[model samples]
Target: MAAESGKIDPMHQFLVEPLFGQHLVVGGYDISFTNSALWMVLTLGVLWVFMLGGMKRELVPGRWQAAVESLTGFVGNMMDANIGPKGKAFTPYVFSLFMFILFANILGMLPIGVVGLHAFTVTSHLTVTGVLAVLSFSIVLIVGFAKHKLHFFSLFVPHGTPVVMIPLIFLVELLSFLVRPFSLGLRLFVAMTAGHILLKVLAGFVINGLNAGPGIAAIVSIPSFVLMIGITLLELLVCAIQAYVFALLTSLYLNDAINLH
Candidate 1:
């Protein structure tokens, strides 16, 4: 069935087809408004409004304020649970990561067709996720260095280990640290890409089945349509889960830096 419609390009949803290209004699980069940039800006806009609106603290909290408070508390509690008392200082960083991803995922799920444009899945692209992972990794490294000074290198050398095994342990530890960003970024990119592909495939099935025949087509299409709706809801939950998982892992990494545990 998938072959009948031709092989669908999973990357098509992430392609940032440039609206225009800029030329410069010395050097230049693409300046055209791409779908990725569009969705990113939209996500930022939503985040700004949600956060700002909620900060206007009132004696009786409004819906927006309550929502913001809930998010804040959620992150705060997560940090405390994961990193103990030392985790309090890391709240801002974790909160920002969570909110950015949450907003991006939710914005992508919106009915963007009303604007006469296709919805772009920014999170599905490895470049974007890799950049975010790198940013988190940098934070972990910098904070560890600043807080622990040169002793931060001890992270790669376990304590209470036999001297003979120290070299092998260090090698394993170093590789694990190096792969943090790749793992974090790939997990998110793969999940988003796979989910979007499934959604597109199911949607195609519904359309093709409807065109095949009135009776048989309708029967098959009904289940496909139902599955599509179910997947849509599941996608929403996945979006939140991915965001939370990213933030949770980030916090855990930071905890290792701060507490050395």
Candidate 2:
């Protein structure tokens, strides 16, 4: 049974099969297609359709237009609430980040089995999350330096500390800043990865129990199906919350950089 289970390897259900090999033998550079890339493209395509469909100016709004407007308004409000008046200039960056993340997350929830291909949750990967965090960090660093020049380094210093306490406070502040990217990436990756793994394990139990016997299986399957439904709904909420948290933290970081407080 263990061997059979190993052969089945439920985790391999999300593995990406390469579509291309190394272009130059010496360089060993390979460009391969991946499930994550497919989902990202799908998300971008969906976003393009929605945004384009709603681009027309009309006296009365259609459903797509309403959705676009609502999403825009929500992001706008979030920027206002989090970053204040200075955030107005950051609206484009924040909105783009929110939409990309939101769509990537929503696309992960689709039932890809019907399409005869396994779906990988892109956000579950530390590499993907790390890239996003690093991008946000770069934006903060660049914008801060551009705006304040050398004075931006003052972010590491606190205003109200005694001379003796300044070193300790500065050390704490510097460490906190250094950990931002790791924390941001890990939080999203862990949440999505854990949720998907839990769902997969529960699903395996359901499948195994159903193969046991009709009477016992039926009793077990009922609760399994109910749990699956509950988990699916929870996953939907998790997707949104993770994206919002990421964008919210990013806005906060940007605010910190701009205001230096």
Candidate 3:
């Protein structure tokens, strides 16, 4: 039974598989629609339906409309708190980012495998998260330069650094600033991947224990099954927390650009 479970490849789930036999190439780029892309489309479609729930304009909102308002209001308040008065203008972008990531993360946790469909966690991929991090950072750079011009360079130097230490401090601050995107992307990718790998390994254990014997099932499979349930709940909480952390950090970074503090 251990051998049987050992044959299960935990990492195989992360593999990007193409849905179609045919391929599309443009400028030497393989733009083929993959399982990852299909899930992203599903994520977007679900999110769109969720948003439409709020369009009733009723004086008293039902549960679905209330949920929509709650999320939007939460994101809006986060921006106001993080970026201050000027944050209102960027609310749309930040809100979109928060919802997309939240939905993507949650969608991956759905119990789709029971229906002969495997859910792909898009956030587990570096390319997707890196693009999001870069896009956020790019906006910061654009806003900083557009508003402050060369004065944006002042961001690297502290307001009261001693003359002798200014150079060292500037270098450290610059390095930290430059690493934001890499760290942001890496954090989410590592987190999502680790959680999924752990869950898959636990599942393998359950399967193996059941097949090994009734004794092994009582000793291992039942416990493993219970543990999987607990971890699943924890992962769901983590999904929301990570999404909030990413959005909050982005807002803070934008504050630096907007206020140059």
Candidate 4:
């Protein structure tokens, strides 16, 4: 819906616009550098610097090295506990997943301006999250089939089902399995999008209130500003929790595929 007069358009923030003045078209398709792409690349670059720059040989680690080491150990221990000893073999992949999502989430919180607009969050897009979720599911599917061959089909069959109910049970399980990617992607997309919308609305209220007559604006702005601050802090916590949840769910799915449970 278009924004009505006198109200802020919260959804406008999610619109993807070309970074360059002129849009780039190639082979009848638009292929322009966008705010979303820019932020994604920035996040990747930050990760590269953090991880590689931390590889110093000093016995007494500096702040940067210490932070990198701590993050490495945190993800490493998460895999060890969640996926057990075999998880170490997949540590690189799982750690990359965790870091990528973590960085993307944190980067979205930045106030940096980009191409006349504020930062664009790649994870705020359903397509981006959907791709990540599908990629994780694909890894699980490939690993499961490689390890168990035709027996991987048994994943949808309950171990001790009565003969007559096998077909019904299989259908239900298969449906659940098929929806995993959608569910995983939707969870992150919805959480981030909703939080941003709520923040925008509260911010709008504060702005609108302050623009009124001085005495009235002062009175109204106080509560709105306070509420906005509370939401901002809550969002900070949500950012970390969502990233951990995505990584944790991926690991759990991997475990199910490997152990066929």
Candidate 5:
């Protein structure tokens, strides 16, 4: 039905268009405000609002407090389990990253279209996720070099490798280590992008079916709608899992820096 009139572009949702028809250039770089940036700020605002909910600090926790504490505690435990005693100092960073990514992801899945609003997922872009991955990798490098100096290079070598095999092992490990940021960023971006594309295509089916009238609506739209709901639920789970995976990988990377193992 939709194809009769026009084809829906699944990639349309991922386009980062400038907002308000305003463009600015700073140092030859396009610094114009974009829909992606807007959603990121909104994500932060939403996160801030939630954080404020737990500021009551009651002796007995309320719903908001429990929700906030649960998230914080989950990240705390993850850091502890992954990095041990040294991980305690890094809990704040891990918690912030986890919360930000989680909220950003969850916000993208909001049914804003019901109110004629558009939803954009920042994590769906490699640029955003790549920056995050690089940030984590940068911190690991800084900490590693600061603590161990020249010995930091040993991170590429296995503990029990024979001297002759050390060269090959080190090269392999080095390549793998270098690929971490790319892999990390690409994982989240790909997952979010693919899921959103699938959802968008299904949504097109729903709209087209409805527009085609009752017969097509019942046949095409209804099943697509039901499947969309299931996929949306799965996407929500993916949101949490992706966030956790990112934070977990960061902690494990930090573990190498702090513990040198």
Candidate 6:
């Protein structure tokens, strides 16, 4: 019965399929190139093109050059606002992080022509997002320890509290600190997953209803198609928002590490 249903599974698109002939396992780990890896490479390629092309020096800046400058300035301002002067040192990392995420998202939204192993969203997977989150968290931890040494542990203890509540406060802060990575990763993963699922279900209704339902069903699908278009547009905005939010939070964490409360 389940096989006969032929329903569209939104999750099917998020599957990480190996791009090579077969899955390659070295030692106990699978490091084979996957659709997600392909997309990540493609994302980097897109950044390379923008960065390289934007290098033109002319009296009047071209579109690509202007775009590149604008994006750089925007992120620079965000860093300055969040992390202050020290943020300049981390601009490259933050800029690259923002661009990688933004491009990854934009690529996934593109209506590229390819089947099976194409058009995967890296951020849709918790593994990918988790890695990014951990990288950000590690940066914060390392910076905190390097700058303050044993005093870094003070971040988990509130500056001022009653003597009796100190233990409870420390426990609460420790739990909150530990959950940062999971929260960051889950935010992106869940948002991408939910938006894609809604879009897929709406599209499936339009396709399946038209092909396999009564005349009334065909009529009902018209609105579904319209809603699908609207949702696609919203998802585009969401892609940018999620990337910005991630980068913003990373900068905030850096700021906290640099000037602990």
Q: lDDT tens string, model 5, 169-231?
A: 999999999999999999999999999999999999899899899999999999999999999
| Candidate 3 wrongly placed segments (more than 4 Å) | 1-6, 21-23
With a 3 Å backbone cut-off (N, CA, C), the pairs that clash in candidate 2 are: none
**Model 1 clash tally, residue pairs:** 0
Residue-pair clashes per prediction, in order, are: 0, 0, 0, 0, 0, 0
Model 4 Cα lDDT, one tens digit per residue, 1-261? 124666788898898889887799999999999888998999999999888998795799999889888878888888888778878877788788888888988888775532344866788899999999999999999999999998998999979999999999999999999999999999999999998889788767776787776786778777888987898889888888888899888888888788888
> In terms of lDDT, which candidate is strongest?
5
Q: Per-residue lDDT of 1-261 in model 2, one digit per residue for the tens?
A: 111652334465455545353232345654566556777788889888988898776789888888899888898999898889999899888888888887887777777756665566778888889999999999999989999999987898888778888888889998999899999999998898888777776666677777777886788866887898899999999999998999899999998888998
The sequence of per-residue lDDT tens digits that candidate 3 reaches over residues 1-261 is 113424667887788878886677899999999989998999899999999977687899999889999998998999999989999989888888888888999999988777777899999999999999999999999999999999998899989889999899999999999999999898888889899888888888788888889999999999999999999999999899888888999999999999999
Q: Each prediction's Cα lDDT score?
A: 0.85, 0.81, 0.89, 0.85, 0.93, 0.85
Scanning candidate 5 in windows of ten residues, the lowest lDDT window is 1-10
Which runs of model 6 end up more than 4 angstroms from their true locations? Answer: 1-6, 113-117
Task: Show where candidate 5 strays beyond 4 Å.
Answer: 1-4
lDDT of 5 at 145: 97
Q: List candidate 4 segments past 4 Å from native.
A: 1-6, 113-117
Candidate 5: Cα lDDT at 34: 98
- Residue 196 of model 3, lDDT score: 88
Q: Which stretches in model 1 have alpha-carbon errors above 4 Å? A: 1-10, 20-26, 114-116
* 24 Cα displacement, candidate 4 (Å): 1.1
Better candidate number, 2 or 3, judged by lDDT: 3
Q: Give TM per candidate.
A: 0.90, 0.91, 0.95, 0.92, 0.95, 0.91
**Model 5: lDDT of residue 237:** 100
Model 2 residue 52 CA deviation in Å: 1.2
